[model samples]
Target chain A: MLNSMLEFVPRIPIAEGTEWVTEWLKEKFSVLFDPIKEHLGNFMEFMSEDVLMLIPPIIFIIAVALIAFFISGKKLGLAAFSIVGLWLIYNQGYWDHLMNTVTLVIIASLLSVIIGVPFGILMAKSKIAEAIITPILDFMQTMPAFVYLIPAVAFFGIGMVPGVFASLIFATPPTVRFTNLGIRQVSKELVEASDAFGSTGAQKLFKVQLPMAKATIMAGINQTVMLSLSMVVIASMIGAPGLGREVLSSLQRSNVGTGFVAGVGIVILAIIIDRFTQNMNKKKA
Target chain B: MPVIEAKNLSKVFGKNPKHALKLLDKGLSKEAILKEAGNTVGVNRASFSVEAGEIFVIMGLSGSGKSTLVRLINRLIEPTEGSILIDGEDLARMDKKSLRRVRREKMSMVFQKFALFPLRTILENAEFGLEVQNAPKEERRKKAEKALEMVGLAGYIHQKPGQLSGGMQQRVGLARALANDPEVLLMDEAFSALDPLIRKEMQDELIDLQSSMRKTIIFITHDLDEALRLGDRIALMKDGSIVQIGTPEEILVNPANDYVERFVEDVDRSKVLTAQHIMKRPETVNIEKHGPRVALERMREEGLSSMYVVDSKRNLKGYITADDASAARKNEIGNLEEILKNDIPRVDKETSMHEIFNIIHDSPIPVAVIEDGKLLGIIVRGSVIAALAGDAEVNIENA
Candidate 1:
């Protein structure tokens, strides 16, 4: 085997080269990561002072009531009202934290969309592109949250930037996978019909395939949002502050009341955001 | 005389044949081509032509490449070998942009599954072709509305494809095709997926649409009955190759072989074929005031095989078979309507001997094609057998 190696130049082992590569990637990633986090922190901290603001949550609660009235009836409406009442009882003040979380989710989701859609298009169009990207998505999805933090800390150091980056990474697969899946799932008969009508490749993709994929892609968006929310708790370990940080702080100090209260607030936030996004998806469908 | 013609247009699926012009851009090595060869010969050098505004149908079982043939005409599937010329323009020579323009402006298609864009409303779906061609928004919308009205889906403008029944969805598909105002309309089993009743409704709608539009149509189907009912000319296919191409009368009365005969064996003769193929020339008949039933009895009395059903003016009326005349006699035969199996298989004076063979075989009984309710002749199994066996001369008469 060693003599056969002479026929071709010997390649270095991955372990020998990966550490330096990792450090280099880490340095390159942080160059722009820290500043964004600092700016996010400043905005979030300022917003925290006005966290007691209640108008939006109250409105949201009412909207939930209206929607629930139609979906599951008055009983569901009452259930929605009680959920709102519980958020109020927690004394965490719903508005500002919810807004900050919303900002994070929106930013993360938008970034995922930007990266996911083009990547999906490329993957769907070519087998080689799919071979390279699909497995990476599988890894991203399967890897533990703690493992994600290693790259996050090494690359963006610590804070909101790292949180957002982690969130984007975690939430990306659905957007990419679902978009590709929906496009692929469209009937071949329809594609042929469109082609027969003299639709060019671009026209076929955008008008026929993309339009048909709407509901499916929306499902992907919903999945991305849900995944991004899961990153909030893990992101707090990187000093990313908000409900996640509060929950962690209370748990560390053995303050069950504080931990439970903050945890409940986070759950309420998730339900509200999930419900709203789900409704948006329904309307689009 | 053909508006569209394919000279030995063979579409083999394998990567390479000795003389096959490679479909894709880069040429592969013979070894690699051999290794990666795809299976199935989709279109086996199919050669047929359609006259301008003629409803030419291709009928086959699933995977017999009937769908492949229609798609190939528009070059939706690039042929592996041979040439396809549409109005003397070689489709193979057209570039991407030119091909697109041809498709958008010259050709349109109706699909087996309707293929309506569910996201868009009915009106928008119809306007898809115009949109692809960059038709202005308002103009496309107006044209789409008009096309929808033509298909009788006028009130369904705002409805999504999912909101409509299968028949309505197919109508929308037709409307979309018409929206392009295309020169040639390609339909691939457009009504195959609908219910029997709905299929009939759509077929009638299509016949009406085609009559008024006069677009050259290339319709594909597995249903022999549909081909007979709808085609001006039917191209019977098997194993990716055309077995025969002729008028309905020629196909029924003089099928090319046993394969086609089996396919048309159960067909309804009165509904499909005409009364012209089987009509016998009157040999010294002076009685002109007789009904078709009386004419049949006269032929029987004179020991003739068949007799012409002519009017007082000595023009041919529809012919009646001896059996048909006798069948009508079970009840008291009084009038011409009572005695005559008035709806016999009829052919044009111009119908080829080939079509007469298929339709007769397709029908439940031997028949002839009629022109203006006048029989030219009668077709029995023997005439078709002689034609296919290549023995007897085809005594085809023009009306």
Candidate 2:
């Protein structure tokens, strides 16, 4: 009887409904989406080809190593790791792909921060906003990275822009969540103290909340960068260029050696980015 | 006019504050209102006025609404009903911009937990109030430095609050408030987080600072002893209502209710009671108008061992013992001053019983309570003990 009752309930057409909504949005908002695609695509292209590629790989590697050294308080470990890791990626003939991947991840993470922080602040300030946004954030975080590519392509066509769209959806939640948590976690007495001194809302945010929440926000941004990096291989399916493309082609041909080297390159990049950002947070301490 | 006057100010913590207020007006008790309407009364119809340059303290146990009352004064916690007047300007009715301006110019607060920004240097923390006011950078810096110096933290301006000890951090909190040079200071259990020794030190320093600054202060504490030590007048709260408001001596001497009486029962009375509270009307001899025979006669009539001799203007000259007066009469000394003993201990009328204890222990006679060289009264060992024993009806006229 239970099985018969369960079978009587028809399946919900969630997929069909979602497809209709996506198509309707695409058809109706082409004017808005088109400009964003064109301008954002051009900007990311200029960043990778014109700005980053213009620098000699050796100089870029040395500069990053030096930054790592100073940021890590004259520690030899991170600086040495950066030099060795970049040299290996360079020797493996994936330096251009590395740069392309770097551009995608950096832009995605930066955009996430720009968008996420305000949303986080809004969520922290209002219970209604928090209630509305929390579920959306959860959906973005839990939905498979592949599921976003369809909307990404519909919105931005293909290549690095679409890649950015997909990676942004995947990576933005941490920054928003962390920023909200960080602001909310500030001691009640501190908030009262700020209010008692008659601090304007903006003054309290800048002077007390943001500065106190810096480390937590930094940790969130680090998570965002890592999430963006992880999306690169998936993003390459939409024709986004980078070490992710190399890994994709290698996977298709079953070339284990080539895929392994590309994977190693991504690991090296992740560690370098993670260590640099973590060290920046520690410098304040 | 009072510097800060709160008239029927109340704070109800719940979604339906109007309902809670109605219940409050209906005379529903705090717990009953909370049970019926799910509303907690934070401060219920609290009315008080703080005079300029005086420390007005609000004291209560935890959850008694003293903290909420202090917060309501500055509108950090907005009142659910009634009004607050700052120098006759209605604070509760002011718009946000004007309220912020008042907060910047009129008052600042110190917190129990020393809420210094952990990232900012002590100088930056101290300058926070001025910075909020948009003062010129150099002016803020100078004021912050001077304020820090006043709090004895001038040397630690470059260091962050995390590196400082709790007491020092609280000093920085005090400096931040002082740097604004506000007309009033709101200190909410500011020293409650410190060790007893540091708390005493901070209290002494605050008293020292207050003597010179003379800013109107609204202080909150759960400690009876602290309220007595620091407050010029104290308002005691119980279950979100002010049970009594009076000078520390009046509160100690005549509690308004059983709750207030119980609350102050355990307080160390020696610290609060003074020479004036415990002193007796001194039996005396007019040495300027009367000779040794008169002094001896008065002593015999009073059945006293010694007599405090005062001049026509009531200036304390000295005391003459019965034996000395008799010896003086035998030796033809006409004046009592010739044989008067000048070794008696003299204390000001405001001297605490704590200090009187030390002086009285070594004295053979009663400690003379004098003001400006005139004898007002005398504190005998019996009077001090009687006061400490909570004997409120000690006969000042009998001796």
Candidate 3:
């Protein structure tokens, strides 16, 4: 009798619900989503495919070294490390993959900052906006990166475009949250002093508030860049090409040596980027 | 005309301010209004006028609405139900653009915390007001440099505000305001955050500055001595309402109520009351017309051993004591000038009573109160003692 009763019991219809919701969103917002998808697709291809290939590998390496030298206060050590790291990646025949990964991370981080900062400023300025955005940011931050990949692929089809969209969603929360916090944390007395001087609203925001909040906003940008880097290997599952793809292939073949080497290369790239961005922040301060 | 005047200024810090204002109109107390409408009355129907070139001080302890009242004058805090007039233009009726123009061109403020931008250099901070006015860069720099020199901060222009001491930062703040060359200055406890020694030095510097600039200034503070020293006229506030408005001498000698009396109870009156306040119309003999016999007769009639000898224009010639007059009488001197002693101590009419202590101690007779080489009055030792001892009946004739 227990077996018979269990056989008749139906499973929850979560899959159908998800599909229906997905189709409903697509139907309702295709005009918005289609243009964004197409523009992002074109921009990603141009950055990763055209720009990386247009510059010679050695010149790119030297340029990176030069940037590192300036950002790190003319430090020979940082410039040497950046040069040696890029050379090692080249020697390992992973230069193209490295550039691809870089392009993806850079594009995603830039888009996150562009969209997130203004929203964050809105949140800081208005209580209603903050209330609405806070929980959405919490969900974006806490959700597993793999869980969103399915939806990303569903929305934009399988490509680097979907990977970038996924990375953008995952990396955006910090910039928004920190920007809001940074503006809010400005000294009340300073704000009052600015207002007392008859500063227009725009002047106060740009001259006083933004300059004061630079360190925090830089911190947010750093987080966004790092989060985009972390999304790379996960993004490889959906035909996004890079060192992440190489690592994924090595993992699939159970080739631990190749996977470890690629992992080390990603680390080297991250260290170089992180040091450069942090030095840039210090210089600004 | 007054530079700034507020008529029945009131500010309630909550919604439903109209209800609180109605209660206030019905003469409800601050607390009663708060209890009735949950509206905190920041300032209550405060009416006062600040004359141009006069240092009008608003003084109160914490939570007494003195700061609020000052901000109301500038429209930084809008009044709930009153009008503020600047040069006969109602601030409440002005549009935002006109208000901004007034803030830029007419008045500037100095903050208690010396609100210099920490990230900006001293020069930049000093030029802040000029920059707000959209002045050209060259003119802004020139004016800022001049103002900084006026404040004795000429060499620290390149340094950031955080690198300077608190007193220096406040000087920069002062320069920032003065750079605008505004018609009025609103200093809200501008020196209250400094060390005691630095605060005293800043006060002396401000007095010096005021002597030359003579800008209409409204100073706010909680200290009685600062108010008395700096204020041309003082408005004492309590519980959001002005308790009294009077000159320093009036406030000290004739406190409006128990609260004001208590506020001034611990004040050092000798330092506050000048020689002009306690001076009397002294007995005198004209040097050109009087002989030793005449001087002696005048001294005897006045029941005094000494008489000041003055010219026809009341120019202080000298003095004649009883011994000198007797010597002159014996010698048959026709003019009192031959026997008059010019060694008597003299003080300006505005010299404080505290300074008179030393003069009166050294002099055998009363100190002569002189102004512009003419004798105004005499500050006797009894009057100094009376002022020091807090004698209420001490004659006070403010110069």
Quote each prediction's TM-score: 0.75, 0.84, 0.80
lDDT of 1 by residue, B1-399 (tens): 777888888676654553333522245433444355544567767888888899999998887889888888888788777788887888877898888888888888898998888788999999999999898999999999999999888998999999999999999999999998988888989899999888877777888878888999999998876887788889998877788888766776667888777666644332222234334444322234555456566767877555445565554554455665565565556445444334556566556545555566666544554456554445666554433322224444532
Once superposed on the true structure, which residue ranges of model 2 sit more than 4 Å away at CA?
Answer: A1-12, B269-399
Superposed Cα deviation of residue B7, candidate 2 (Å) = 1.4
CAPRI quality of model 1: medium
Off by over 4 Å in 1: A1-16, A26-86, A93-99, B14-38, B266-399
Which ten-residue region of model 3 chain A has the weakest summed lDDT? A189-198
Q: Which stretch of 10 consecutive residues in model 2 chain B shows the poorest summed lDDT?
A: B390-399
Give per-residue lDDT, candidate 3, residue A255: 99
- Retained native contacts per candidate, as fractions? 0.88, 0.88, 0.35
Better of 1 and 2 by lDDT: 2
> What clash pairs does model 3 have?
none
Q: Model 3 over residues B192-263: C-alpha lDDT tens digits? A: 999888987888899999999999999999987788768889999999999999987677667799999778
**RMSD (CA, Å), each prediction:** 10.0, 7.6, 8.2
DockQ per model, Cα: 0.68, 0.85, 0.50
Model 3 chain B poorest ten-residue lDDT run: B390-399
Q: What is the per-residue lDDT of model 2 for residues A147-213, given as tens digits with 9 covering 90 to 100? A: 9999999888999999999999999999999999989999998898888888999999999998888
Model 3 spans with C-alpha error above 4 angstroms:
A1-18, B25-37, B267-399
